[model samples]
Target: MLSFIVLCAALWVSFHLIAGYVAQRLPLDWLADLPIIGASYGWERGGRCYEWLGIRVWKDHLPEAGGLLRDGFSKRQLASAEPDYLDRFAHETSRAEFGHWLTWALALTFFLWTPWQMGVFMVVYGGLINVPFILIQRYNRARLRRFIARSARRSARAD
Candidate 1:
């Protein structure tokens, strides 16, 4: 179990590092943003809707106005548009990089000295590393929306 946990952690860390590098090299920033978005959306959707056959839940909703709105706009807009809905999506991807590094550090430390620690570390570190990206993305989206809204309102008033 300890070995498995360590292996899983190592795999996850490697995946993240590789993905991060690939994302950085891409011309589109949004591509790099996908892991953060996908992780967050998957969590929020409870691995359901999209994970059924490896399809994203949000992907299905893209055709509808509401879904499009939710996917494109920040949490604030989603909340305003769908008053009953909650906005938990993330906007920033880089915020979680440090957490990923910490996870790797902890994993390596445990692998070297205390294998039993791997399980606990995985549980805590996994959540810690992924959750902030969601929050950050949500925050960035909201900030962008607010800026757009303010600008639009100011323009309207001036007109």
Candidate 2:
């Protein structure tokens, strides 16, 4: 059991490293525009479950440069809210979220090597940690897109 846990940990690390590397190298424009996942679908509009996770409070604790597994390339800063920047950041964020989803899926595959009980435990554990991140990504993307839209409308009116 201990060995299994250690192996699973190693697998998690490797998946993150490899996935992040691939995501960075890929031309992610098409992937970023993937509508289904990119649409926050009102998840960020109001009393979101993410607020309960203290994401706003805790997010910055992570290194801005992420790590080998995640370059943290898409993080949005209020100070840099230019429309073009927000648009690009939102797409970058969507791409990162996709990478994270893949990481969770790839890691969960190894749980098959463990007993059923352990596998279930691993699945729950993975969700607990990754879900907040998923939520944060969706929330940020939604807001960014909205801001971009508003900016466009304003510019059109001005013209």
* Candidate 2 C-alpha error for residue 66, in Å: 5.3
On residues 1-159, what C-alpha lDDT tens digit does candidate 2 reach at each position?
799668778877787677667667666587676776555556556326466778779766654323334444647465586876777787877777776776666656755576677777767776765666666777677767767888899999999
User: Candidate 2 local accuracy as lDDT?
Assistant: 0.68
Residue-by-residue lDDT tens digits, candidate 1, 56-157: 323333221212222232222334333122222222223233334334444444455555666567656666655444344443444444455566788799
- In terms of TM-score, the best-performing candidate is 2
After superposing candidate 2, which stretches have Cα over 4 Å from the reference? 43-54, 63-79
RMSD of each: 13.3, 3.1
Model 2 TM-score, all chains together: 0.77
Stretches of candidate 1 exceeding 4 Å from the true structure: 1-16, 26-124
Error of 1 at 91 (Å): 7.4
TM-score of each candidate structure, all chains considered together = 0.36, 0.77
Candidate that would win on lDDT? 2
